[model samples]
Every structure is written in C-alpha cells, then in structure tokens.
Target: MIDQTPLLDQISVPADLRTLQPGQLRQVADELRAATIRAVSQTGGHLGAGLGVVELTTALHYVFNTPDDRLIWDVGHQCYPHKILTGRRDRINTLRQAGGLSGFTKRSESEYDPFGAAHSSTSISAGLGMAVARDLAGGNNHVIAVIGDGAMSAGMAYEAMNNAGAMNSRLTVILNDNDMSIAPPTGAMSAYLSRLLSSKSYLGLREIGKHIAERFPRQFERAVEKAEEFARGFVTGGTLFEEMGFYYVGPIDGHNMDHLLPVLKNVRDAKDAGPVLIHVVTQKGKGYEPAEASADKYHGVAKFDVVTGAQHKPKPNAPAYQNIFGEVLSKLAEKDDKIVAITAAMPSGTGVNLFEKAHPERTFDVGIAEQHAVTFAAGMATEGYRPFAAIYSTFLQRGYDQVVHDVAIQKLPVRFAIDRAGYVGADGSTHCGAFDLAYLCCLPGFVVMAPSDEAELAHMVATAAAIDDCPSAIRYPRGEGTGADLPEVPKVLEIGKGRILREGKTVAILSLGTRLQDALAAADDLAARGLSATVADARFAKPVDTDLIDRLARDHDLLITVEEGSVGGFATQVLDHMTKADLLQTVKLRTLYMPDRFLDQDKPERQVADAGLDAAGIVKTALDALGIESAPDETVSGKDRPARA
Candidate 1:
C-alpha cells in the first residue's frame, strides 16, 4: 500500500521543486508516481505512460526554469506526472471528467503548456517552430521537446529534425526510448544503436573528451573536435543524428536523477551548441507492478483498484465496433488469400490484432507512420491484393495527402476502416474524429460510408472488401454496438443506397451514421405531438441515395438531416444534391451536426445533446421548423412528454 507523500504535499509547482537537492528528487519521483496511479485509479486515464516518465518529469522541472523555458510533451499521454508537478496536483482526481482537466495537454489550460499535443510525433515540429520564433524575437529561453521513440516513426518528426538541423536552431530533443509506441516498436537498428551509445564506456569517453577539450589550445581545438566526432561515430553509433547536424548525447538511464540533472544542466549551459539529441532509455509503466506486467493493457485503462489492480470495465451486451470490424475482415480474409491488413502502431486499438492472430503473415504493423501505411497499402492494391488500412479517424488526418494522392488519384482499392468516427468522450478535441467525413468525401472517386450500427458496419466491411476499382472508406463510432443481431455471413451492402425504417407524411428524418437511433426516438416524440415522421438511414455520405432523398423531399413538408459529424459533411452533401436537383423549393430543410467550434472534454451523450442531435433537441428543431410551440403538460403517446416552453 502507498502512503501519503509529505514531499509532494509541500511542493505545488516547479519553483518549489527546484529548492530540493538532487538527492531528494528520487523520493519526489516515487511520490509523484504513487500519486499519479492513485489519481488515475479514481478517474480512469492513461496510466502507464505517466508512470514511466515520473523520474524524468521531476528532474526536468527541477533542473529547468519552466513557464519561461518551454517544455513540450509529445503525444501528451505521459503528461500526468508533469501536470502534478506543475500546479495541478490538487485537482488531479478530476482528470478526463466533464469540465475537468483534459486528458492531453492544452495551451489554454496553463502557461507551462506552451503547445498542446495529443496526436503522436508532432512535438518536434511544434518545438522547432517555437525555437525559431524565440530566435526571431531575440529571446534566450531554452526550448525542449520530449518525444517518444514511437513518435520518431512518423515523417513529421524527421521533417522537423531536418529543418532544425538546417536552421541551426538551439533546441534540445529528448528521445524517450521506451522501446514501445502504442504497440512494440518496429525498427530494430535504432534501438540497437541507442543501447550501444548509452553504454558506460561510450558515455565515459565522451565525458573525458569534453574535459580534455577545455584545457587544449585554440589550434588543437579542431583536432579535438574531429577526434570526438570520430569517437562518437565509432563507439556511440549515432551517425544518423550527427549527419542531421545534431550533437548527439548519451542513451542515459532516464530513471536516474543524477544522470538526468547533470546532462540537462550541461545542455542548458552549452553556449554555441546547435540542436542536440539526447537518447534516454526508459520503460513504460516503470514502477507500478500491474502496469509493468501488462504495459499495453494498462496503457489506457478504466477506473481500477490501486491496491489490487483490478480494472472496473462495465460489461457490455454487444461487441465493440472495432472487434466486429476485425472479426468480419478476418472471416473474409480466410476465403481470399489476397487480403491483407495494415495498422499504424495501433494493432489492439484498431482491432487489427485479431486479424494478425488469424493471419500473422498477412497482417502488417507499419509503426506510427500513417503516411507510409497508406502508400504501402496502395502498393499492395496495385499488386492485385485487397489491403485494409485500419486507422483512427483523427490519426488519418495526418495521412490525408497520401489518401488523396497515392490512393484516390491512382484509383487504388485500399479499404480504409476509419475507427472513432465522431466525438471521442474523454480524449477531447485533439482526438475527436469530427472532420473525416468532410475531408474524405471531397476527394474525387472516393466511396465514403458510415455505419448506423454493428450489422451495418459488418456489411460495410464486406462492401469495402469487394470494391476493386477505387478507394473506399467506412467510418464507425467508438464503443460497443446497440445489441443488434449480427449475421453469420456478412452481407455486401449496395453502393449509394439508403433504407427507410418507418414511413410518415409530415416530416422526413435522414440520418447518415449512428444518429439513426436518436432520429427514431425523435420520430416517436414527434408522433406524440400529432406529427407523422419518416426516418431513413443513409449508409453512404459521398454518393447520397438520390432516389430516397428526392422521394423524401417531394413527399414531406419538412426534411431534417442528422449526422454525428461537423459541418461540410453528410448534411452538406445532401444539401448540395438537393440544390442541384431543384428539390429545395418543395421542402423546408434542417441540418443537425457538431458546432463549428471545437468542444472541450465531455461525455459523448452530453455532447450530442448540447449539439442538438439528441431526441429532445431533434424534437425542438422539428417543432421550430413548423412554427409550432410545444405545450408544457402535453401527453405524447403513452408517455408524459416535457414540451419545449
């Protein structure tokens, strides 16, 4: 059992932490680790990443002048320990709750958080920009970007490194090499080189050269530099970083405060040093027993018992959308030998792990490189293979260029299984899959789809697998299905088609995705008010079922379109079709979608209600369109309906 931390209680911010001796920092790290675990146990969140970085977080804050000297965290999953030290210790229990602290870093939340980050591999680019801005402004503050080894796989990080090298910007990049991204890292040579460079003998030789160079004459200085460079290249094996114009430092033990403090101090005090890369080897879920035992399982967990490590995940009646996709794909791949699956370091999160288990040789994990994953899938498609690139909707934004240029432009049949289609609850704005519909539909010859439920998702998966002429994408929301009965053999859905569930005369509701359930409920409420409502499920967003839309437009007085996406998505497509077909003159239209602005962290249900996509909200919108005010105490059907006053 962990006890209350007296040292942690006394230190509220980095300033208070700086007063402590280097020897005392270890205790502080322990306390912070315990605190983070305890806090996350109360409110479920990213536990393992933060636990791994406790010592590093403590040392960085203690050694550096933060809030002045900028410290940016890549991916922000490991920012929990940093948050505790940076004046948010008291409110740590409120992590990821509605109106509470965000799961990731936010610029508006605190001055210490110079750049907000949740997506992987963006820190290097953002930090380099900050460093360049500081140089332009004649500022002397140090800019440090702490990035994960997983993040290094993305092209964006390399692009930033190349730019920083050319610019000769004074920047410090701490590569936290935990040997794991979301899943186990793909590359082996980098890890081998890091381990070799971080060896005791190599670091000792580098330290000896630094001391010798201080006493040498001006003429011997160049010779000493050449010797040091050759020694680093020979023993340390960091030629890649050196070639990129960065002075490479140790693969140091990240958990050791003695090692971290002095190295950080040296880097901060270096007068003319250009960008430096410090490879620090650390472990994910370092101190916590349960987390260390199963790193991936504990990466993002529900509320758990701190003592027992038993997670409190609510039992769901239906399978998750991810599992359904994986199962259907695996079943299809058994029949077709040409089927292959790809993921960008998220095998389990995307449910590609299931497919990997079934067909280990066919499954490819392309690390955290989404752009590569897309192009690689396109290459497989050219060879007459069906490649399913299963990536999160938010992360797919990073590979949009490749999606258009490599797949859409070439007319490759790469099936994009877009997971997390709309508002993600605890992960907040940075991870929300709000713009995929708008972004994907705009591409020429791309077949875009969204599933209304689990069964539809299975059909869409089969539909995407069969399409061989062009790029196809099917988006589904995060979480379990609505307990709908799934078919043993998934049926292939027809392209550009919609199905009507209920028929009515006065109002027509067309829902594109998971919002069909809400539309059905709204129809019931509308019927209570003596208004007949028709509900239709629009399976495809790109080539919207023109026949169904035209029929609805002609038959109904008011036509309402709802989707769990932002503007310029499904509703926009429907409106564009209606406008071109001259159907707008007959029917009054209302579109319900996510607001233009980004929403902060909140429950998915609350977000939908607030965005006016819920039953009550839909009823209000329908009633307002007809210029009818709801009676306060009206009986709608058999239920007591609270009317909009």
Candidate 2:
C-alpha cells in the first residue's frame, strides 16, 4: 500500500490532532482526505460526503474538546473522516464488513461518536437534547451538531432549531451546505465577515446594543432591531434563521482550514450565546476528480481502483429488483395516464429515476420529506391518480402516520413500492426492512404483497396497480433478483391467495417474501433424509390464506412458517389465524424469523444465516419439531447432534 497519509499516521486520536499547530491543519486535512479515499476504495462506503467534510472534521476536533464537548453528526454519512481522526484509523479499511466498523456513526464504536444515526435530519434534535441535559447537570461543555443541506429538508431539523431558539440553549449548529451550491465564492472578505460575526466581541456588542435599545421607547427599540436585522440579512442572507431566533453566521468556505478554524474557535469561545447557526458551504467530492465529475458525486460507491476510480460492481445474472420495479411501473404508466410516481429525495436509490426517464411530467422528487411524500401521494390518489410512492422500507417508517391516516383511513389507492424489503448488507440494522410487514399488516384495508423472484415482483407490481379501492404495497429485497424469466406482459395475481409450489405429506413449509427459495432448499434437504415436505409461497402477509393453511395443517405432520421479517410479521399473522381456527390443537407448528435483538452489519447471506432464516436453519427447525435428531455428520454444524432414542 502507498503511504500517502504521512501526516495522518502521526495522529492516533482527536487529542493527538489538537496537539498539531493550526498552520499544519491544512496538510493534515489533505492527508486525511487521501486516507479517507484509500480506505473507502478498499471497503466501499459513503465517499463523497466524507471527502467533502475532511477540513471541517479537522477544524471541529482541533477547536473543541470532543468526547467531553458533545459533537453530533446528522445521518453520519460524513463521519468517515471524523472516524479516521478519532481513534479508529486502524479499522478504517474494515468498514462495512461483517463485525467490522459500521458505515454510519455508532455510539458503541467510540466515545467520539456521541450520537448514533443513519437516518437523516436528527442531529440538531439530539444535540439540543444533549445540550439541555448538560445544562440540567450543571455542566458547561459545548454541544455541536453538524447537519447536511439535504437533511435540512426534513421537518425534524426545523422543529429542533425552533425549539433550540425558544429554549435559548447554548448550542452550535453547523449547517453543512454541500448540495445547495448557492453560496458565492468565499474569499478574504467572507472569511473575515464569518469570524467577525461569530466572535465574542460582536456578540457582546450586540447584547449591549439590545439593552441600550430597550431603555429607549418601544418604537425606537423595534426600529433598532429591524435596522440591525436588515443590515445583517442584506450582507449574509440569513434572515430566515434570524427570524427563527438564532444568531446567524456566514456561508463560509468549508474546505479552507484557515477560514474554518477561526470561525469555529470563535463559536466555541462564545459561551453565553444562544443557539447559533454557522452556514459552511462545501462541495461534495471536493478533492476527488472522479467523484466531482459524476452527477451523483459518487455519494454511494462500491469497491474500486484508487488509480482509475472504476468501481468493481459484480455483473448481475438477472435484473436488479429495483430496476424491475421501475421498468414495470413505467410500462404500466404508459398505458394508464393517471399513474404518477413520487420519491422522497431517493430517485435513483428507489429506481424512480427510471420512471422519471419515461414519464418525466408524472414523476415527483419530493426532497427528503417522506411524510410529505406519503401525504402528497395520497392527495394525488384522491384526485383519481394512481400515485406510486417508491421508497425504501426503512424510510417508510418516517411516514407511517401519513400511510395510516391519509391513505389507509381514507382508503386511497396509493401503491407503495417498498424497495429493500429485507436485510440490507453494509447499511446494517438502520436500513433493514424488518418491520414493514409488522407495521403494514396491522393496517385496515391494506393489501400487502412480497415477491419471491423477479417475475413475481413484476406480477405483484401489476397486482398493486390493479387494486383501486384501497391502499396496496408490494415489497421486494435489494440486489439482483433470481434468474426468473420476466413475463412478456405482467399479470395481476389474485389478492390474499397463495400458490403451492411443491407437494408432500410429511412436513409443510409456509414461506413469505424471498424466503420461499430457502423453504424449497430446505425441502430438498429434508428429501435427502427420506422426508417429504410441501412448499407454499404465502404471497400476502396481511391476508392469511386460510384454505392453504388448512390444507397444509391437515396434510402435514409438521408445519413451519418462514419469512424474511421480524417476529410480529407474517409468522405472527399465520399463527394468529391458526390459533383462531384451532389448527394448533392437532398439528405441530414452528416459526423461523429474525431474532428479537437488533442485528449488526454483515453480508446479507450471513445475516440471514445468523438469524436462522436460511435453508439449513429451516431444516434444523423442522427436524427438531418432528423430534427427529440429526446425525453428527449433518450439513448444519455447531449444534448439539443428539442420537435418536
């Protein structure tokens, strides 16, 4: 490996970083950026964000006593550089690997990561909470929240800012404006202005002016406040933040250490100041040529060559599930003019970009407001438009209230295209689609469907599009689909009905979502042991297929329910139906699902295997339920292999 980060090698932690002189920080930032690029090239994580904040991360740690003074990063995408500076540089290359460093900031990982986050727009709120807690505990430590421009689109950030303003707390919010690209070029004047505004002298002078104005008549005081606001607003264009009751600073250049260090030091020294918003303009992929040239700024990347910036993405044997959803939806929209697509700031991630290519007029990119996206889709649905809200399963949790109230309660035909509906590798538990089944199945008049393969996903899209009276959702996992042939024309399947794939008499496997293939594999394993197992794909999680359940219960000696979801999902629904029907009285039943505890980052296959939702797990569960012990030489190892009595 090339030793490009000579300056970075000297620093083991943020304290080590603070030991360096301010003049040496520019070299440190350059080396840190190089180290970040080198690490991400090996591990394939969020690159552009970390690259953008290399200088800011250096300045923050240098100016403030971190771990003691709480510093929170919103969504934690830009924390890779922060991680490299804060005692985790050794594990930087092991990022997103099984049992290695998490892709996002994790509290358990290090003391530097004060708040854990993967979801956006939560830093300000968490920082305010910490600040308030510090005040109550009679601690005078600083609380700083670093949030991105994209994350500011969410209502939560604004709500936190509003609260912080009202509470008059000693908090500093760093608005990292990387996306807006609205700031003029920062030079000596702008940096000087930023330093002047954030300095303690200016703050004290302003407070004295306020007190002096208060001694005069009410009209005169009001005029003085307006004059001061107008002068500052005209110069910095921070009237909105000023109106929200925060002391506003500049849109300074974030890459310049000379500019960043002084402004940050000024803010840190302002102990008696209320909540302050420092607008720092940054460019995503600032130091990386390949990322800067790309349209999405290489926001998310795969393992790549450091010399060429060419990603080593595996060639898909079949179409990706996300692309299939997009193509199928676009095709449906061609025939039906009322079909519209909406996505909350994840057009490409959710495959809405494909939809936008064909039907540009009908597609809506609703920023990072999932709740607004949900309600907006409902509004379109009310106007007789078949609005498809394509969102990640984890992100849909942010808009559950809108899903329940605006769509489910009103019975609107908003088709929810839930992408990434299972264990997502690398992104970890925060992005896992584990609870969608549990949350959506509980809703009244909801048609929920999970596809087993690519063909099935296409068909389910048609199924959800066909449903007009009530809300419908079709969930599919991330990555490439199984090599199933796509139908020339997608056909709508019968709602609340399941199809039996194989027949047997000894045991039955009722599978939901992508676990159907695992169920079939388990059946094959059982067959090798002289056992016959029936495999059925329970397509609908909400509507329990009683007829199929009854037949499986009556025919098989052991019946098992399997799904790629949490405990209270498809398995719970099936068990609830079985209990009400008294089918549990005669037949032996078992359930295979994700464990109760939150799982950490790992490969998707490894995560499934660990959770006991794989084929081997199903086979073991079946054998254990039937009171038939496996031999010591069995394929599923590391278990107590008891001899048969």
Candidate 3:
C-alpha cells in the first residue's frame, strides 16, 4: 500500500485548505481527488459525479467563504468531493455505511451541505430562496447554487430560473453541464445550453460588457448594463437567461480552475445583486478512465475493483427486480398494442431501455419531467392507450400532485411501474422509497400492489393494464430476487387480495412485499420458540387486504405488520383499516417498519438491521409482543421449519 493517508491526512476542513497559498490550490485539489477515489473505492458510492467535480469543489471552497457563502449542489450525488474537503476526510471511508455521512447532502450531516438535495433540479430554486432570505435578514453573505446540466432539463429548474431572473436575487447558479445525471439527460433545455456554450462570443462579450458597464456611474451603469444584457443576447445566442434578467456569466471549462477561479472571484467580488448564472462545463468522470467512459456504471455502484474497474460479483441466479420489470414490460408491450412505456430521462436506470427498443414508437422519455410524464400518460390513457410510467419510487415524490390530480382524480388507468421501492443500499435518505406507500394509499380508486418476488412483478404489470376503472402502481426493490423460481407465464393477480405463503398458528404476519421470504424465515423462528407465526404476502398495500386482516385478526393470537417503508405507510394503513372496522382492541398488534426519521446511508441489510427490520429484530419483536420468552434452538434459516405445535 502506497498509503494515501498522507494526501487525506492533511485535510480536516476548508479552513485548512485556506492555509495553503494560491499556487497550492491545484495541489490540494489533487490530494482531494485522490482521497475521494480511495474513499469511494472502499465504500462504493457516487464515484464519477464526485470525481468530475473535484477541481470545482476545490475551487469553490478556495474562492468563496463556505458555510457563510452557502454552496448548494443539485441532487447532492456529487457532494463527495465537497464532503472530503469540508473537515470530513476521515469519515470518507464510511461514506454510505450505517451512521456515517450521507451520500447526498443532508442539512443535519454538516453545515457544508447548506441546502440538502437528493432529487434533481432543486438547487437553483433552493439557492434563490436562501439568497432572498439572506437579503431580508440583511446578510452580506453570497449564495451560490451549483446545478448539473441534466438538472436544468427539469421544468422546475426553468421555473426557478425564470423567477430568479425576474427577482434578480444576489444568487449565483453554477450550471455544471456534464451532460449526464445518472444517465444522459434529454430535452430542449439541453439543446439550449449546448447552443449557448457553442457561441464563440458568449464568454468574451459577457466579460467585455461587464467592464463597460463598470466604467459608467452607478444608475446609468445599471440601465446601460441592462441594455447590454439585451444586446449580448444577439452576441450570446438569444440569451434566454439574460432576458429573464440574470447576468449570464459563462459556459466556462469547470475543471479548469484557471478559468473557474477568475469567474468565481468575479461573481463573488461583484456587487451585482441580481442573479448571476455561471455555466461551467465539466466532463463526467474527469481523470478517472473507467468512469470517464461509462459515467452511469459508476453513478451509484457497489464495491468495485479499482484496478480493473469491475463491480464486485453478486450471487448469480436471480435477476434484479428492476431488470425483471424492464424485461417483462418490454415483452408485454410487444404483444399488446395499447401497452406503452415511459420513463423520465431514466431509460436505462429504470430498465425502460428494453421497452424503448421493443416498442420504439410507443416509448416516451419525458426528460426529468415526472409531472409531465404523469399528465402525458393520462392524455395517452384518454386516447385509449395503456401508458406504463416507469419511475423510481423516490423520484415519483416529485409527481405526487400529478398522480393525484391528473391520474387518480380523473381515474386514468396509467400503470406506474415504480422501481427501487424499499431500502436502496448506497443512495441513502434522499433516494429512499420511504414515502411512496403513504402518498399512494391516500389516493382514492388507485389499485396499488407490491410483489413478494420477481415473478409477481411480471404478473402485476399484466394486472395493471387489465384494470380500466382506476389507476394502478406496482413497487419493487433495487436488487435481485431471493432465487425463487419464475412461472412459465404471467397471470393477473386479483386486486385487493393477498396470498398465504406459509401457515403458522398464533401470530399472523402480513409481509408487505418481497419481505415475504424474510417473514417466512421469521415465522420458522417463531414456531421454534413455540409462538406459531403465519406469513401472508398482502400483495396490495393500498387496499389493505381487509379480508386477510379480518380473518388473521379473528384467527391468530397476535397480528404483526411488516413493510420496508417509513411510518404512516403500510402498517399505518393497516391500523386505519383495523380501527375503521372497530378491531383495534380485538387484536394484540405489532408493526415492523422504518422509523420516523431520515434514516441515513448504509447497505440494504445494515439499514434493515439499524431500523429493526431484520429477522432477529422481527423475532425479538414477535417474542416480546406475544409475551413469549426464553425459547430453545431458535434460529431462522431459509430452508427448514420447526414443528408447528
């Protein structure tokens, strides 16, 4: 080992970096980059985006006084470099580990992550808001929002831009146009940015215009500068942002601190109280060959070999839940004329690439526009086309209003194939599918289902299209199934019903989704402890499977509910139903669910353990609630079961 500790050893905080002379900034940048690579290699998190922003991160902290001059990063996946330099160097190795720093920016994590982000296109809006607040409070501190080019494609980004431009808040919006956000970002905003950058006079004229404006007296200078902003549009390819009233700076080379430092210094030092947009273009995975070629591969990865750039081998056999959804949806689309697929700029990430290829005409990528996708699907549904809006459960949070107002209120049959439903390993709280259940369950006439296996996901897709009365959604996890055998053909599962996977005695446990296998293991443990447990895959989290609940509560000793979602989710729904039926006092109850906190980053299993959702946790809870203690040979295995007394 060459011991990278020396490079990482020196960095404790941004204040430490300030101790170095101006010439030493690049040296510190190199050290931060190396430390980031070393740390992320061990932890296996957002490598490419972090790697790409190394110099930019170094330069921002170098030029601007951070924690004071709020530096807000969009999506926060690229915050690793920022985290490393901001006194968190030592905790880098535990990047996404339990109780460690979050992979995304968190308000509570550190002061460095001023405006926390997990979803895309939120930085400019958040930063502008902070800038306005700062002005109201009479604070002189600068506010800078760094957003990716991909994030700009989102309508909210434009909405924020349009408003910020008009308000002329003393804010700096750094557009890190790397042309990628997990995957290649699409839409017209991308093209507009490209054209703005391609204009030869864009940067030069903007600078020249600034000098001329500065030459005149204050009031005349302000009006003249405003006119130049209009004239510069001709020079800078129509300048949409300038028209919106922002002083557009550059589509400068982001990695080049030679370019970055001067521009940042100019922006920071300037008295321009109006919004200043600094468009910096950087390469995704800059300096890292493996990630440079394939940014998506390194976006949010597992432990990988640094030397060969190969991801650590997972157990072979079962397909990931995402892959299953993608493959099955594509195949089904081939057979059904009405079945079309849609993903919001996440073609490959959501496994809609298969659907894109299979049904090329039917496939539509809305480009970071989740709200539009929902409404678009609704329009398609009205035209007699079955649109499957394949979106991640977390990202769908952005489209809640659309789901309720556009889809559910009107009862449009838009099949939502929600991927990454449960505890995603590396991405942490921002990306966790924690709130989907509560949001989805609240909608009337919406048929929502989650599969206990990969096989059931395929069936749910078929079932969603078959229903024309109301909207339907099926949520699944990010990883592989439990190697459960697949059926030869898919079948439509009955809406609002559940399947009994295993039979037990006193305690009945409702497995919300794929957690059924683990529930089975826990049931075996319960039986061994002489507290017989029944396992049932509730299938539908929305409808609550009232029949299953009523029967189980009537027959079993205690009723237990388990789901990999936040509180006010599946268990809460169950409680509401049980209360509605006046069965609250009729049954002893327990619920194994995620807590009411922003559970930080960790592996899926570790998070489950941390949240008390593991097999041992389940067993302990069941034992405690049932008033059973001091059992014998009480280990839960996948295969064997104890005698069911």
Question: Per-residue alpha-carbon lDDT of model 3 for 226-334, expressed as tens digits?
Answer: 6765665554443777777677655566666666776677667666537877767778778767887884737766687777778786676788877778788777776
Off by over 4 Å in 3: 1-11, 19-21, 180-231, 295-297, 584-586, 632-645
Tell me the TM-score of model 3.
Answer: 0.88
The C-alpha TM-scores of every prediction are 0.92, 0.96, 0.88
The residue ranges of model 1 lying beyond 4 angstroms of the native Cα positions read 180-227, 295-297, 631-645
Which one wins on TM-score?
A: 2
lDDT of 2 at 473: 93
**Ten residues in sequence with the least summed lDDT for candidate 3:** 181-190
Judged by whole-model lDDT over C-alpha atoms, candidate 1 comes out at: 0.88
lDDT at position 274, candidate 3:
71
C-alpha lDDT (0 to 100) for residue 613 of candidate 1: 93
- What tens-digit string does per-residue lDDT give for candidate 2 at 1-645? 335777788999888888888999999998888889999999998999889998999999999998899989999988999999998888998999988999999999999999999999999999999999999999999999999989999999999999999999999999999987556645788888889998888989989998999999999999999998999888888899988888889889999888898889898989888899999999899898999898988899999998889999999898889999999999999999999999999998888999999999999998899999999999999889999999999999999999999999999999999998889989999999999999999998999999999999999999988899999999899998889999989999998999999998778999998888899999999888767789999999978788999999987778999988888888888899899999997688998888887888899999999988999999999889877796324343212333222
For model 1, residues 1-645, the per-residue Cα lDDT tens digits are: 459798989898899999988888889998999999999999999998888889989988987899899999999989999999999988889899888898888898888899999999999899899999999999999999999988899988999999899999999999898875222322344444444454455556766777777788866876877776787766555568887888787667788776777778777777457798987778888898898899483899999999889999999989999999999999999999999999999998899999999999999999999999999999999999999999999999989999989999999999999999898898988889999999998888989999889999999999999999999999999999988888898888889999999998878999988999999999998888778789999999988899999999987888999998989999988999999999889889999999999988888999899999998988999989987897335433212323322
User: What are the Cα lDDT values of the candidates?
Assistant: 0.88, 0.90, 0.80
- Measured by lDDT, the strongest candidate is 2
